[model samples]
Each structure stands twice: as structure tokens, then as C-alpha cells.
Target: MMTNAIIPLVYGLLIGKSNDDYNQFFEKLFEQDNFQPESIMTDYEGGTIKSVKEMLPNVLHKAVWRQVQSKGLATKYREDESFRLKVKKLIALAFLPVDDITTAFDLIVDEFDEEADDLLEYFGKTWIGEPKRRGTGRKKPPSDHKL
Candidate 1:
């Protein structure tokens, strides 16, 4: 479901999960002519991401934290309970303000050893994106894509 509110509005449901299915959904959605969305939240589906970028240029897109957490647990889990706790904190960075996210992430990375570096790098580049620049000029509003 594509949601603009806490209770997401159902966009479309398809029998098959494919790029064409997503494209069809978006095509029907845009047919309304007044369905401009400021931002969109999705799980880590490559096809969905591609479709959203192709169909809704300039829309802000973010990976849902629940999906990211499960992915991290599957890929980066360790026997140490403390390490698991740290990874949980890093995963929770999705809730942080754009300005504070990068610094908080770096601190967590520093606390962990090289074992989690790949996970951290993936989170940094794919989810948090580059740190937002602090300056006075017409700063671009931060989003998942452009930091």
C-alpha cells in the first residue's frame, strides 16, 4: 500500500510482484491527475524503487525501518549480545532527524569493529545517505536519495 497517512491508503494489489505490476499501479494512480505525493515510504524492493523513481520523479522515498531491521539482522547478526544491541541502535537511526543521523551513525560505527563495517556502509549509503551539508545557501531539502 502507498500511504500518505498513519493508516496507509491502499494503492493497488497485484497477483504477481513485478516491475510491470508496479508500473501499472502507478500509471493508474497518476491517472487521477491530482495525485501528487510529496514523499513515499517503501520496503527494500529494488523493483519498487525503480518503478517509483521512473514514475514519480522528484518524490522523496525512504526505506521503512522494519524492513531494514530484518535485513540487518539476517546479514549482520553476531553472537555477542552487546553487538546486537548496538546494531539495533544503528538501525533505529531511521527515526533520527536528517541533521543528526550521520554523526550518530559514525559514533556507532566507531564503537563496533570491522565485522559490521559492510552493514554500516550499506546503511549509510543506501538508507541514511550522505550527511546533509550545513550552510546558508539555498540548501536542498534532505531526502533518502540526495543528502
Candidate 2:
């Protein structure tokens, strides 16, 4: 899909939503040299993000703000007004310098403690790609099953 200042410029409806589907969409788009865009805003779809990075490595990728907020509503903190507000702040961290986003994110997570533990884990794993580890801070032992 392509847009110009919020107006849809072009788009394609695909039967499947997969990395390959997105790849095909973007690959075809690249055929037009003028299709290169400055930035792209989209929902946090893993396949779309991966395809976008692979196809338009130079273009900035951003999450759609409203969609991001809606995700927070589905998380564990849904009922807490304060938590919701904090999440909005957390999402706004994208506006900060890249180097500062992680520290600020951690601070917000720490403030909620157990209440936001699940949400924190989701954010860390999905967005930050934080490595999973044991509570002791040690890496898990390798699986015993043979390949």
C-alpha cells in the first residue's frame, strides 16, 4: 500500500497475509523508481515489518499510533486509567531520540511492576526483541532432545 500525506495513492488486496505476500507487494512497487517513499506508518505486523525492512531498508518505518493504543487496551492494564495514560506516554517514546527509548520504556515498565508484567514482556519480546532468560539471569540449558 502507498499513501500521500494521508491520502491513499495505491494498494493491493492479497488473499494471504504473510511475509511473501508483503514481499510481492513491495517488490512490485519497487519497479517504479519514483515509488521510493520517505517513511511508512503501519500496524505492528511482523511480516509487513520484515518485508518493509528487506525491501525499503532506507525508509523509516513507524507504527500507526491509534493501532498501538488499541493494542494497549487489549493488554493486562486495560482497566486501569493510569496505566492506559502511561501506555500512551510509552507509545509517545517513539518521538524521543532512538538511544533514549529503551531507558524510558524500562522506567515505565518498572513503575507498574506486577500489574504490567505481561504487557512488559509482550512489549519487550515483540518490539524490543529482548532475549528470553531464566529469572536468575542465566541462559536456559540446551534442550535434551536430539534433532
Candidate 2, 1-147: lDDT as tens digits: 665458557667878789899999888988977887866766667777667766775453344233444455445344677766766666555456655666677777777756456556666655544654545222222321110
**Candidate 1 residue-wise lDDT, 21-101, digit = tens:** 889888888888688886776765666766876787545334433343555654444456776677667756655776777
Candidate 2, poorest ten consecutive residues by summed lDDT = 138-147
List ranges where model 2 is wrong by over 4 Å: 1-5, 63-147
Candidate 2, clashing residue pairs? none
- Specify the poorest-scoring 10-residue window by lDDT in model 1: 138-147
- lDDT score for residue 80 of model 1: 64
Full-model lDDT for every candidate: 0.63, 0.60
TM-score, candidate number 1: 0.39
User: Candidate 2, overall lDDT?
Assistant: 0.60
